[model samples]
Target: MTSPHRPASHGIPRPRVWAPLHYPGFATLFIGYSVSSLGNGMSAVAVAWLAIELAHGHGAGLLIGEAVAAYTLPGVLVALGASRVLKCLDPRLIILVDAIFRAVSLALIAGLALTDTLSPILYVSLLGCSSLFGLLGIAGDLAATTELLPSELHVAANSLNSVTSFSASIGGPAVAGVLIAALGPGLVFAIDAATYVLLAGAVLASRRYQPPTPIVKSSSAGIRDGLRALWRFPALGAITLLCVIFYGLYGPVEVAVPLYVSSVLHASASVLGGYWTVFALGATLDALGATSIQRFGLWRMTIAAVAAWGVCLIPLGFTTSAVIGFIAMSVGGLVYGPFIPLKKTIIQRSAPGELLTQVAAASGVFTVSASPVGAALGGPLVAALGARATLAFSGLATVTTALVAVAVLLAYRRRTRKLSGDR
Candidate 1:
């Protein structure tokens, strides 16, 4: 059996957190992905803002919702069909194709906007087209990470990815706000399109450094194979379930937090912004330092994080002070940061290499949907319980879910151990 802790280097001292970047191929991919993610973060704001600009008076809210949905919902469908459509392609090729498609679609949207010909309908349709391959792109990126770095560095690599995403979330919107005021959302979309072209070029340039592609037996069962893999692997299934619940529970925070700040605390938009900014900063810090907790075990770390996140949210539920709310959100972000990296690390380690992308896509289908469903449900929850109570309810429910998960997982582990002993 192979040990899991093999060093990236033979003898020279190197920081474990940055170990994955030492590889040239991964480093190139990281830089391109980082640049592109910043663009993505900007688009997250620009898309909705542009939707607001184009929407007519009576239908503005509906059109904005449609535009946002167009950007995200297609990725769920793409992830669902990935096993069938993407089974034969190299992960890197999938990434390349996805990037090119995004670049073209976003460029088209930009062109239409610049020419003043972009209708709301066309804008929504193009946004949908742009995201059709989004989930596959993410699956390919993670699959490529496994290929580019050793197993031990996966957590660090994933954490670095998380850090980039969090940082972009902070910086992208701020930049987009400024750019949209000066150059308009159309030009921002053009900049975003350019970033995807750069990503495509990076993918092309990294070809020489990538190891020879491994042959995977093609599957016709579509996502069922990935689902079956989850059922067949106990650990994978458990972690996926935990993630679904965890994310689902967090969705209400998105809906409730702003409401809480406004209705309960009587605060301004700037206060809400400040609360989230602090949260993102804490999350970024935690993600940057994720490698330090590797020895404590990913499973324990995930569970602990979930529980701590719940505890953090409890404070917000009871507090009327903006300062207390900010502190709670900051701590919540710290605990929440490790959840994604840890989940990806476990999935990458547990799944067979050939099935990795499919497994990830399959997992994405559930995890991606979880939050939206929770957010949709949050409307009724907030109505019934009010914002402060809703926050408390989400936290309490999340803690209970984590406790139940722990008991179930422990029982399953003991049973597996006993069965192994008998065999």
Candidate 2:
């Protein structure tokens, strides 16, 4: 039986469920995220392909990695700055600008690839575009968490938002990979550009959510306070710390997987994209079962799923075929559903209303930082140790991290219970 204290579950239907705290604003965000995730999936595909081209075409490993750096490094530097401006701009306007800039960036990448003009100058432009996109995302996050809802539906809003990306991860890359193979990178990039157009259209259609307050603060003290709250507040701090560990392990798994397939497994490019499609589909399926996941124990299950994900990687190291690798990734993706939402809910619940965006942006910033670091380390590690050994070692590290997280959470929970009893 469920505990009396469980949050109300919104019964929508099998595979199509809702949270009781649902608001119409989340629906808008959900539509936007789904479309945006498709675009994101394509952009990521382009980046990895771009990396591969740079490394092999010019035989420069650092050059390829550097190209991708334009995408990630700026998120770390600009997250706080974005949080400050997020308070001033209309969230929708920010998203529109973000989409436009990113679409232009994709067009630039395609132009460079098509005309044979790929250059360091182009990479710098990619960096600038990525920075703008990151800021826009921070604004969207804050707007989703606080400005969108009035009466404490933060957890549900976050979960629904998660569902959108989950869906896009399933469909976008699978198709893009095929398109990239059939038509080339330019078509894939154009598809992403179209996705942004659709996303802007979706935002235009949604009616219910408007920013409740204008957040034009005179000083960015609000940004500073958000960072301070993360450290000062125990729950938010703990969740953030654990999530950092999760993402650190998760980084190489997603970012480096394509590189692994081509370089190590000797798989075709089409197969690599399909592998991600399978993984994303699994994640989507996992999200569908959120209601069941809650009753069974969210924390313990997240721990087990993540650890199992690590264990799955061990077998992936032995796989010679792309089919085997895709199967392995899909199995890992099965756990991804509950894992992401549980992590997000932990933060949304822990963060206070006023500082929600800053907290969310901080989380994004941390993820942004850890992923590249993991990839940077993984890339050379793959080059040095070979794919199988590097994967095995990464797998072990992930398991170790999960074990530490479980122990930490258990200790904290026990102490909290004791205090409650004492009171």
Which number leads on lDDT?
Answer: 1
Structural similarity to truth (TM-score) of each candidate: 0.95, 0.79
**Root-mean-square deviation per candidate:** 3.0, 4.7
lDDT of 2 by residue, 1-423 (tens): 111223323332222246533556556666666777877766666666766665566645666567667776665676666654556655565666667777777777677777767775575567467556665465465555556653234444555656667776666666767877887766676677677777666556553454445554546555566678678776667666766776776666664577678887777878876777777778777765554655445556667767877887877777677667877888877877677666565565566655666667666666657766776567677777777777777788878878987888788778878987999
Error of 2 at 64 (Å): 3.3
Tens digit of per-residue lDDT, candidate 1, span 1-423:
011222212222334888898998889888889999999989988998899889856688888889988888898887776666667777777788889988999999999998889999899999999999888888888889988887778888999999999999899999999999998899989999999999998887777777548757674665777888788877778888888998898888889998998999998999998988888888988986567775667777778889989989988888899989888889888988888787787888777777888878888888888998888888888989999999998899889988987888688768877987999
Pairs that clash in candidate 1: none
CA lDDT of every candidate: 0.84, 0.65
Best by TM-score: 1
Steric collisions counted per model: 0, 1
